[model samples]
Target: MLRYSAFSRDPAGGNPAGVVLDARGLDEREMLAVAAEVGFSETAFLVPADGGFDVRFFSPRAEVSFCGHATIASAVAHAERHGAGGLRYRTAAGDVDVVTARDEDGSWRATLTSVPPVVRDLAPQDLDALLAALRWSAQDLDPALPARTAYAGAWHPVVAVRSRQRLADLEHDVAALERLAAARGWTTVDLVWRQDATTFHARNPFPAGGVVEDPATGAAAAALGGYLRAGGHVPLPARLTVLQGEDLGRPSTLHVAVPADPAAGVAVTGAAVAMP
Candidate 1:
């Protein structure tokens, strides 16, 4: 298994992912075991399928339909060995297309186009439970960006806080959040603070995945981009940067682009570095 940190140029930053370039013979049990041994938030196992590849993601405790950091790390790993180009990944969520290229600084960056995103209003009861688990009152939320559940491969509840301080001081009941997430089939709670028109700060609590938080969440970022476009939160054809994991001391950055077409997939771009 190859180790990589996605969405950062440095190894110590970003979210770490384990990449298994070849897992042709491994069964589900074996893959889960390996992922557990790797002990990262998630691990990618690639098996050649139909001309592209069939990718599976496993967290330490369970299998997930999609994982953004693992996808980014796996794409970069493939590009480093097979040369930069487009690659198709058949994930449990859906077919995802990723493109990798070398940057001017000689670092490799990968861009993954998410599946068509969906944004839905959170039920009042569910929202109340979520806020209770998160220990965040309704008044702390941003009025402009209402609470909604966004889905792009994975489902995330996008909760936009009014102030950066509200986002920074994150303290949640993990067990309560996990129960709610599992009950609702949510992957993460995307806590965000908008910095400006093109900048934002985000924190993702991934209780269902068996992780407390994610340093960089591409799937949630994509979902948020789609939500912004669909809800007119951001202008069409907008490129936004999300800064995450800084509070965890492993800073990471995610670049998201939202197009005018509401049905189209959002684009998420970031660089990955091999971990030593």
Candidate 2:
């Protein structure tokens, strides 16, 4: 298994993912075991197909439909071992297209296009339960961005808070959220604070992954981009930046491009480095 940190130029800064580039013979049980042993939020298992490869993402506890940080790590690993190019990942959620290239500074950067996104309004009861689990009231929320459940491969509930401090001081009932997420088919509960037209700060609690919080969440970022475009929160064809993991001391930067077409997939870009 190759270990890599995605979304940060520094190895110690980004979210770490385990990449199993060749898993042609491994079954779901074995993959789950490996992911559990790795103890990262998620791990990628790849089986070489006709052109690109069929990939699977496993969290420590369960198999998630998609995992963005692991995908970024796997693409960079493939680019380094083989060469820089495009890759098609057939995941359980959907097909993801990734392009990897070496940056001018000699680091590998990858851009992954998610599946067509879908956004839904969160039910009042579910929203109330979510806020209660998060220890946040309706008054703590940002009026501009409403509560919604979004999907761009994996499903995430996006909640935008009014201030950065509210986002930073995130404390949640993990067990309650895990049960709620299992019932709602949610991968992560995204808590965010909008900084400006193009900048935001985010924190994701990934109870489904058997992790308290995900340091860098590319999947959530893409879903948020879709939500913004669908809700007309940001200007069409916009470039947005999501700052994450600062509270965890592993700062991560995720660059997102949202198109005018609400049916189109969002693009997320980040860099990955090998972990020692």
Candidate 3:
């Protein structure tokens, strides 16, 4: 297993993920053991296949349908070992197309196109429960973006806050959220503040993954991009930036592109580096 941090070129920044470049012959039990031992937010297992590779993501506690940071880490590691190019990933959530290239600074960056995105309103009761669990009042919500659930690879409830302090205060009820996540199939509760027209600051509470907070969440970023596009909050064919992990001291930056075509997948780009 290889250790890498995604969404940042610095080894100490971004979210750390374990990448098993060649996971052939390893069963789910073994993979789970490896993931548990790695003790990162998530670990990725890559099995060589005919066309591309079959990928699986596993948190320490359980298997996840998709994990964006791990995908970026694995893809960049693969590119460094092999060559920078396109790689198809067959995941539980859906098939993802990833392209890798070297930046002008000679750092590897990977961009993954999510599956067709979906955005929908959150139920009132669910929203209330989420607010209660988060210790956030309805008044804390931003009027511009209504409460909603979004899905690109994994499902996350998008809750926009008006202030950055609201985004930073993330002391939440994990058990309550775990129950809610089980009930609603939610992977994370995305608390965000729109810094500007083209920039956003975000914090994600991932109860389902048994994590209090995720430094950089690729799937949630994609879902947020879909939410922004669906609600017409941002101009069409827009490029936005999400800044996260600041509260955790490991700042992560994610570049998101929302195309004019609604049917097209959202693109998320970030750099990854091997961790010592």
Q: What TM-score goes with each of the models?
A: 0.99, 0.99, 0.99
How far residue 200's Cα lies from its native spot in candidate 3, in Å, is 0.5
Candidate 1, which segments miss by more than 4 Å at Cα?
A: none
Which residue pairs in model 2 clash with each other? none
Candidate 3 lDDT over 9-52, as tens digits, reads: 99989999999999999999999999999999899999999879
List residue ranges in candidate 2 displaced over 4 A. Answer: none
lDDT of 1: 0.94
Q: Would you list the clashing residue pairs of candidate 3? A: none
lDDT of 3: 0.94
Q: Rate the local accuracy (lDDT) of all candidates.
A: 0.94, 0.94, 0.94
Worst 10 residues of 3 by lDDT: 204-213
Deviation (Å) of 221 in candidate 3: 0.5
Return the TM-score for candidate 2, rounded to 2 decimals: 0.99
Candidate 1: clashing pairs of residues: none
TM-score of 3: 0.99
